[model samples]
Target: MRQRTGRLLGPLLVLLLVGAGPDGSGETVSLDGDRPGERLDVTLTRVVDPAGRADSERLVAVELRLENTGSVPYEDSPAPAAHLLDTAGQRFTGTAAATGAGPSLPDTVTLAPGDSASGFVTFRVPAGAGLAAVQFALDAGLGDDVGHWSLS
Candidate 1:
């Protein structure tokens, strides 16, 4: 019985550690998504609102830090690779033009092991849209892994 308990403890400890991530408001928390050999750490730094009514439709932006913790390189493309999901399940795709207004990910970033890249993904949102989450892909849907962050 003692040997069996010891064996279980190893896996249990790993689970406990893996479950931990950046703390969030009571409504949500940041998450780290990994699939075997590939790992991504996604953190939602902040959400920026539009400056005025005229810009409201194309100004909202979500700032994030994307880290490649895997041993492989993460290829980045010029095309939009992320989307904002609102409370009502509406999807706001990333805007290419909006990226010029702020610090953005490179057109083609190839991350080495333990490397990271930070950037802003802007979206055209309705006046009353409430963003609750973000979905990001390194290969724009061609790859099997995607990183998700919750903002409740």
Candidate 2:
């Protein structure tokens, strides 16, 4: 009975550790897409309302850190494909207008093994919209891998 219980706890412990964020705040996701061996780690570093309006719309800035954990190079533009989802199921794409509101992510990114990049992606949502999560992807969402960070 002790051995059986140990086996059950072993896998459960690994699962919890693997899913846990380093700082206990953001999430880390692998961006393999069609590549079998590619492993890119994306972490949501911060998210904030930068205090301003864009034609009756409020701006939300999402800060992210991307690290190349695989053995190969990962190159793509993540800013254009980043999105904001509201509680009402409304999806808001990253906006260029909000770029001036914060330090925006580069239009192109090339990450070699062990390389990392950090920047912000901004979105314009309705004035009173309740943001639920932020969705981010490479290749303008054409890739299979997508990372989501919950706001609440």
Candidate 3:
């Protein structure tokens, strides 16, 4: 009976894995045209507001794509900081008081020439979290081009 159960689960797992497709990031992305040694090309995608549809408390996340097209590699501290500007223009992270807080995971990355990375910028929205615009700023290893986004 156990052997039969294992056989059934194997095919199911394979089917599930095969169905997951590539996310929107794919072959058609273009890096910002900046002079080498200038800055990283950051393309803001979406802001997942923590406030639920009803504006209750939930997890807020920002998503963007960062690519290094410069002559030298992007340089940053061991753990540089990412600041998220809430609707009120207050920083959500990296300030004395976390007006809004997000998961403090590793939250760091570096890119060699022509390297690109994508993921969500997660945070905790205050009780009165707004579901609109959130601005993001990167301290280092990034270019002058800032990222902007709006949630539904």
Candidate 4:
């Protein structure tokens, strides 16, 4: 009976950990991409509001780390599409104009198996807006698999 309990406990712990989605800030999420056998492990490393202010809109930079954990190579020439949602349910798309906030992600990245990359995706939000979450997807937001990270 002790052996049986130990066997069941292992899988149960795994499920509990994996079932907990990336709802907490700084948690890593594993999601499949558009292609078969393609998986990406993503983590929201940090979010920052730079000190400089050149416009009325605020620039929120989200730093992310992406790793190719599957067998196939992951390639996104223009980088993945990312969206920032506010507490009021308003959504904002990623903007290149916000690159001034910090070091931006490369326009293109190709990662082989076990490769990883880290960069920032910036969004232009209202000065008073409260951020809620961020959504990232491959294939320019057309992919079925979208990974979400809660910011609140």
TM-score of each: 0.63, 0.75, 0.51, 0.76
Q: Weakest 10 consecutive residues, lDDT, candidate 1?
A: 1-10
Cα displacement (angstroms), candidate 4, residue 9, comes to: 31
Candidate 1 accuracy as lDDT: 0.54
lDDT of 3 by residue, 60-148 (tens): 55555667767667544212334554556665542122224332223456778888776565555566645444333344414233333
Candidate 4: residue 34 lDDT (0-100): 67
Indicate the TM-score of model 2: 0.75
34-144, model 2: which lDDT tens digit per residue?
465566777777677754677988888887888989887887777777788898999988743445445677877888899999888878888999877777666565555
Model 2 bad stretches (over 4 Å): 1-25, 96-102
Model 3 whole-model lDDT (C-alpha atoms): 0.42
lDDT tens digits, residues 1-152, model 1?
Answer: 00001112434622111221322212122222233455555555666666224354646666667677766666665237677778899977775444444786555667676887766667777888776666665455333344455555
Let me know the TM-score candidate 1 reaches against the reference structure.
Answer: 0.63
Clashes of each: 0, 0, 5, 0
Predicted candidate 4, C-alpha RMSD: 8.6
Can you tell me which runs of candidate 4 are displaced by over 4 Å?
1-23, 50-54, 77-80, 96-101
Q: How big is the positional error of residue 139 in model 4, measured in Å on the Cα after superposition? A: 1.7
Lowest-sum lDDT 10-residue window in model 4: 1-10
Q: lDDT of model 3 at residue 50?
A: 48
Off by over 4 Å in 3: 1-38, 51-57, 77-81, 94-106, 140-145, 150-152
| True-structure RMSD, every candidate | 9.0, 8.1, 15.7, 8.6
